[model samples]
Target: MGIDPKTIDWDSLGFNLIETRSMYKATCKKDDSWSPGELIPFGNIELSPAAGVLNYGQGVFEGMKAYRTLKNRIVLFRPEMNAKRISMSTKRLCIPEMDEELFLKAAIEIVKDNVDYIPPYGKGSLYLRPVVWGTGPVLGVKPADEYTFIIFASPVGPYFKGNIKPLHLKVTHNFHRAAPKGIGNAKAIGNYSASLYPSSLAKKTGFDEVIYLNAGNEQLIEEVGSANMFIVKDNVLKTPRLAGSILPGVTRDSVLTLAKEKLDIEVQETDVLLDEVCSADEVFCTGTAVVVTPVGKITSEDGEHSINDGKIGIITHELRSLLLGIQREECEDTLNWLHPID
Candidate 1:
């Protein structure tokens, strides 16, 4: 069971972990299939001192959220996409791939068991984190003999500290996000670990996040920290193509689709140059956590450039409003994106 709802101050909730009542867990051994997972009390589990995830950093994770919608129902936004992405991530990390059905099942189980922790209809959402780890002990630099999968839930408000104020981003010429043929496209835990240093340095300089450039091409942009980058110019929306370094974000895909089908905007996935972004009409980043955050200002080696006069642009606002409307079931599910849980 979860804590009393009266104990929670939903208005002041931030993007921090507040443990829920239950979680999902399953394990798989090398050369075997995954076990049928079950809902268990939410708590930390012991791991081997020489676990493969500890030594070699063999792990991957997925982020998702369940919303209490205006329709008085609990729902998830495009969870199937998350299932497919996590499957790809597991294969890249050499962990046993979980069946897509099992992945969806575990996600639902954890969220349902912790239903009480879900915030009220307009407050926030229950953020779900599904992680797969190389749990078995390993001596050499190789895949683990066993793997573990877990799903947990927490109620979170906004990803940004001050809410959705347009982000202040800086381009880092000193550090690149990932190599051309590396696991940059995968949701591996190691990939995020590599970003911590650069991102922290940017934050220390009064920026919200760092815009990573493609390691292979210095003039090209890769992503905004962990989110995908997009720039709008002359009424056309352009983002970096799905090269070897950029992670294909679910929110990015949705925005692209909605922009083309709904807004009638021309969408381009090409090599977006740094110079092009600095002069674009609007800039934004998208991800599961950020949803669609407009970029107010972009700072580079040259100087600071204000996007849309340090305000959210028309396209960005429409896309975010459309995205949230669908998530909250306030508008028609035109693309069948929402998955109802109740």
Candidate 2:
């Protein structure tokens, strides 16, 4: 009549696990020595009402995944990269610098402990979220002295719920996601919270996602809400270079490497004008969750334009399959990007 994830057969792309448990947590003290991190049950967190994160929006986070490889082993895709990015976010938010090795250790432990939740070959994956935030009471406007770092795991399928249709996007020139010297690069909660309203408005208007451009000039593309953008034209891959404005996405980096070495394509990191992208043969977005998603059409106040026959282009699909092959352990990981969990 009913079944649990563990009860299902571990066939290709299926999620079947007997039991799920354990999480990693650590508390940061003002003394700079973090309390010994521990493995605990998956549960709720207790935070102070007046914490800096609540009042002043002082928090940051990162997203990663554990894949079920062909060898039936669990591996994380460049987790150290995510940890390093979190460190950068902390510095930007005035948070304490955490030991990267220790953080990686905790992350690995959490995924290994909850390995059963990892979906079968093509099913899905175990999504890991590492969150760091101000904790304890802090009524002042400055950063909080106390903090908490926690890692949690969940079995997730596709990022978008419905059919795997290429997204229809809207280029927004009015609202901007991040500012020149602001906290846009960081994976801070407030940055996403700020995007909710505008994104919701776009959805109501029939646009799948809103492509937020720079505030000053509507030329440079920053990022989608949860992913970064890329353009493929004449066998050349172009993405917005890391200005202080865009979030440095790990998947974006991976795709660039794959395009150059494996696919024998030229990749460029430069500022691309919105008009220039209109001429591109293909466009796609990349992130840890949505590995590579194509953009079929874009509508702006200026008017709508079709991107490469308004279909998922050949280059986008090829790159996505190659990357997913490595992630799912279906293909050779030549770059040694996957780290196996104990």
The candidate scoring highest on lDDT is 1
lDDT of 1 by residue, 110-158 (tens): 8788888899887889999999999999999999999999998889986
| lDDT of model 1, residue 79 | 95
lDDT of 2 by residue, 1-342 (tens): 112457544444322223347678998965485555998887777777898788888889998888887888888999889989888897788777667888899888888777767777666778788888888578767878888888877676656544568888888777899887788888888899989888998999999889989766777777876789999989899998887778899999999999999989999999888887777899999998778999989887778889988888888999998998998888999999999886
In model 1, which regions exceed 4 Å deviation?
1-4, 160-163
Each model's TM-score, in the order given? 0.97, 0.93
Q: Give the TM-score of candidate 2.
A: 0.93
Residue 13 lDDT, candidate 1, scale 0-100: 91
Taking all chains together, the TM-score of candidate 1 against the true structure is 0.97
Q: Which stretches of model 2 miss by more than 4 angstroms?
A: 1-20, 31-35, 160-163
